[model samples]
Target chain A: MNKKCTTDPDRSYKQPEFDLDKYIPGHSVDCVIVGYENQQLKILLVKWKLGGPWALPGGFVGRDQDLEAAAHQVLEERTGLKSIFLQQFHTFGRSDRHSRFKEQMDQVKAISQQLGTMDLKFSKWASQRFISTGYFALTEIKKTCPKPDFLSEKCEWVSLEKLPELIFDHNKIVDKTLKHLRIQLNFLPIGISLMPHKFTMQDLQKLYEAILQRPLERSNFQRKILKLGMLHRNGKLLTGAANKAPYLYSFNLEKYNSMVENGIGFSYLGDKIL
Target chain B: MNKKCTTDPDRSYKQPEFDLDKYIPGHSVDCVIVGYENQQLKILLVKWKLGGPWALPGGFVGRDQDLEAAAHQVLEERTGLKSIFLQQFHTFGRSDRHSRFKEQMDQVKAISQQLGTMDLKFSKWASQRFISTGYFALTEIKKTCPKPDFLSEKCEWVSLEKLPELIFDHNKIVDKTLKHLRIQLNFLPIGISLMPHKFTMQDLQKLYEAILQRPLERSNFQRKILKLGMLHRNGKLLTGAANKAPYLYSFNLEKYNSMVENGIGFSYLGDKIL
Candidate 1:
């Protein structure tokens, strides 16, 4: 049932440094690093050097590390970002999760050999059932310097709508993360993490539309968001058509934090729209 | 650093049957079975026969079980309820989580001996760091038949306000669960899971108040909930003061389901209340 590794076989493989004894057994962390660019929502994914399919940037939990810290480490390694809005949305622990890859033990041994490491325990450990905590991180797209790890060939941002078939249940993990982001839009200051400090009303609207996965009536959306009073209107953006320029605004952090603390009811979309 | 087992030792001990090979190594599921009664929220907890402190009714994930199915299994074993509204809230995996118990390896061995089992591997496994997924379940309080497992002495409901210090990070788990419940109030049909089939508006208000941890303005609450159109007005509850009798209502399942699917905007509580 092994899927052929059609990736370039001669791509230099770096030996993965893992101390099995220094890590927690049967548990791991997978991060869905989400960023916004060109009004499109994108997630950071890594392609394995031994390649079957692309996967979320993930790693095992350190024996002495917090689950959240493990996720943060993965986020930092892949995106070079810190102090971001990272949340543990869900834990994926179906017994058949590993088996879903449809790879055989021989494949694991071969991959281990190709990596210049013949650790039998590492191969067996990698093939065992692992309950992975899924974390979704919101980071400023322009700031991230995406880097691939020893086991990965490339680290790139993939648009949400165009996500390729991911390895194991990683696809489902991304789906779950997006669902959480939509629900959390009511409670979290998402724009603070994903948008530039000064953004136009259309930029903000597009962000909302991107997360919500639907178009909202412009006037209605603007009116509802302004009513929340967590935004401070700055000078208008000076475009070629001066009269048609939209006002630039920034989040009033104090008011925004307070509003989020009390839980904002972003019900402007109404019952007809989610 | 062992917390002494203070329960009466003379009480007959039953040998717990657990095959370590049949369970996932380092992951578990803890159920915060929440029930509402007498206008207060209550959580189901289990007291160990060889006591330290009461704990959330929890168990290891079966080698072949889904993470959620493990939570449901724990819920069914403790409360005799199935197909409940269960949700995974958070995963607890701090490096010091187990160490916070202040329990030693000797304590594990002693407990094993008391249960007529001296398997060192079992003792070691019990003492190892486990990443436990926390799930909160909402069920009708009266319908549940509370029962303890072989390792426990009593299964009982304790009011949230009066919760005794729970073992390890269980108290923290309950706190996180309550926080999630409050935030989810805007989206989930919690009333349908917790309330009786036919209930007065006052009864429903109490449920909301308990979850929100504050008294809401009555008329304002009524206006907002009624506007949602998810409740069907049924016959009036004729009391001793027939003229002052309140109307009984039930969830209009079709409308309620649709509203929930589209996400309800319960902003009536305003920014002042969470």
Candidate 2:
């Protein structure tokens, strides 16, 4: 295209001028995809290629894309899950979050040189201070195919209780998400994403315990979850160690969808299951 | 304060920085203090003195202060409520949110005259792109005394139901906060903040209804809230309207605090009253 700025009155020269820097500094998105497998609650994290530092897999939004759409796109790229139950929990904007990048400025320069990027602008963009918006996902572990990006050597589930030292303030991001999750447990269909298509009552209870970081009485857990009217008994999961086979259950999608629409109209307290 | 450039063997001179623009832009914190009073849930908003546009009561974070501390400080300055529970909800970082400030650049001279500031730095700061962290608070409406800053003409409660068109996506921020509030109703001890020290069950229910944006069944609502073991029934409120005097309630602060310290393990769905 010929230089449109020179040819048209409505082009760049006549168009609006914006002071981008004044609005807000470095903005980014970090996703915490919480999944369940083997009766354990797990979080999807990435291991860096060089330092092996784990992080809540995240990315920056493009200038042209919607902020939320960018989060969805990031989720799709990291975990092969699309249009899932995702919610924006919190935004982490503390200045020290950028301190790690500052400390590794020389390392970044060396890497850029190795990657044959002589452009100073690209380097600056890479190291710019970022304020990250946090989005959490409830995913079915078996369904997701997590792939590590260019900067990461591994992308896999790490139990929330055994979390690694995450890069930057990512651990804090996960911590915030967990708090939001605990608060929203009754309102949100957490089991739908965390559990398998068919899970035993024990499995469901364990998932809650994992997220809550405390064990709940078995009978009460069963009774509470069933009262929501969002579960359907499927069959049975036979275990040699158990005297009786626990009935397998699945989330009643119809009821779950309606609850998500109308809300569960429920609240939780000590041993007072909804 | 003389310039200390010298040719001595040990003397070295650092280059002068280009300007404020040369460094990364700073972040901003916008507060959404949702207050409950008179059967309505309201948000604190400010109308700019320089312009007629309204926005969520907000301010910039100082470089040295913690972001959360800065947010709390902003809340204290805007509303005379200190040490309130303020939580960061989301960050609005879309490039489009800066368009209004950018569009005002053409008439910078005229705008500066309206703002009455010779410091070009302040004008540049006002007009630049910003990524603002959204912080929310739950508070008793009557307890706060709203005061507008130099940039605002009015600071007052605008009912969530009948909010005016706010400047540059602040309406979106308030909406998102409400959504979070609804999800958080299960875990957060909101009555401690939004209700008076002593209130009737009806008052508490109204607050919930306002936040949930739905009318809850009265009998079920009473039972569910009561079952939480967090409310201590005080003497009934004598009303001129005359029915059975509704029993006044005050939060069992010890139980509520303990529940928050340790996770509240049970949830009350509004179906089974007892």
Candidate 3:
């Protein structure tokens, strides 16, 4: 807040390269960059550069580019993260969904103040009836840097429990994404992808507990997960506990990815005390 | 084709009630009406009035309507069906997805001939970059009284096997919906919603076989399905076979719905023969 940040809101205006021919006007792509750390689920949000509420980092799709590719581009541009697990869950299309976020208009006003120009065409372009597609990505939080786009002031990862007041129905989108993630957890072996290399059985259990919001019996959880054949036992972790240390494990990426793509048959057993 | 039906492509032109304000400019809703009967899956499609390729029944959404409601309205307007099971699966948003359907433009060209007027404004409105949300519904084929809209020549229920080349990417949309449906079959007890009121185990197994696209061992499938506790044993059907009569079952709607909302743990048990 003291020094001028490298990024500014007027980057697009600074470079008058686009004339609507290079962009898809009435559609946008938003990424829900979800990361897990310290047993807490967090999402990355960008504060609009000009004094507005936080918004899911999003951008317009290019005229010739695929919607999915545009989401990846936005993800990379906003967070500097690449090649992570991304899924397109839903598209928000209520007519008034975008219009409900009046606070975001302050961003336009601030841009006008900064640039010393009140461009009506820019305002109209911003206020168009835009239908947005939401893509969610799961990445290791500590592995990459998150940089805000030229239109945002800062990039922050906020915990799901204390999420700020998001613009529009982003909160709803996040909720839907969480539900989808939890559902996928039942069928997809995401532990390895969401975890670091060589973690203990307790660490894996903690991840499952965080997502499922329920406790699992140590023996049963280990048996059920190990039965899937997606994990490889690697030595042991000294947890300083009274009992024997749990075995260290790493997921077989090939097996984990195949299960993610074609789903593993592990959801049938209820959260029973097996 | 024989009667020169009262409905035609120029119907909208005949009524000048609609202005530019009536529709949400660049978003639409499409419905994949699926029905199961005779141990096969089928989908309902509409043909363009001016002799163009067939398409899923779809319509531009109103300026202030929810996208899901628009899908249901489109389904009823085209199929005379209401209050059926509908799910929003995905949204299609490729830049060239809408523009590549040049053959469908013949309908607009035909409208110009029938009305004796060239409506350039209509053509411009039709060529906008529209993004569409896809919704799917399952209903009984025999009970449906499918009726085409003013812009469609006829309504037909096409089997998935002999599906005709559809307009735009509707075929792809249907294929995607089927994949989602199959994945969901692993989680949802849709047998009751997709079947007649009271059906025997053989009938239910046939439906499962149709969806799973493989044979299920008679005893094991029955045991697995019954274990879900979402089904109620009604009576027995005398198959007149050399064995015992197959029992009839109807889904307990409340249990079935709860399972649908929170997926039934049925996906893990693989399609293993008894």
Q: Which candidate is the best by TM-score?
A: 1
Clashing pairs in 3: A268-B265
DockQ, Cα level, model 3: 0.42
Model 1: per-residue Cα lDDT over B157-264, one tens digit each: 889989998878888899889878887787777899999999999999999999998888899878878888889999999888847889999999998778677777
Tell me how large the interface RMSD of candidate 1 is: 2.6
Candidate 2 iRMS, in Å?
5.8
> Worst ten-residue run, lDDT, model 3 chain B?
B1-10
Which is the leading candidate under DockQ? 1
Q: Score the docking of each candidate (DockQ).
A: 0.51, 0.24, 0.42
Model 1 Cα lDDT, one tens digit per residue, A82-139: 7888988898888888776666445645565465354666777777778899999998
Give native contacts recovered, as a fraction, per prediction: 0.68, 0.44, 0.53
- Candidate 3 residues A1-274, lDDT tens each? 2133344333332334535557767778889988878898888998876576788988888778888889888777665656878889998877678776665655654463453333666566767667889998887777646677656677878888889988878889898888788776766777765788888888888888877778878998889889988899989877687998878899987888777776675662465311
Please write out the lDDT profile of model 3 over residues B1-274, one tens digit for every residue: 2223333333222335545567777778889888888898889988866566688988778777777778888877665657888888998877678677665655655553453233666556766677789998888776676777655677888888889998788899988988787876866776776799888888889888877778888999889888889889988888688998877888888888877776665752464211
Residue B19, candidate 2: how far off, in angstroms? 11
Query: For the second chain of model 1, what is the TM-score against the true structure's chain B?
Result: 0.89
Indicate whether candidate 1 or candidate 3 has the larger lDDT: 1
Fraction of true interface contacts that also occur in model 1: 0.68
The ten-residue window of minimal lDDT in model 2 chain A covers A6-15
Worst 10 residues of 1 chain A by lDDT: A1-10
Kindly report which residue pairs in candidate 1 clash with one another.
none
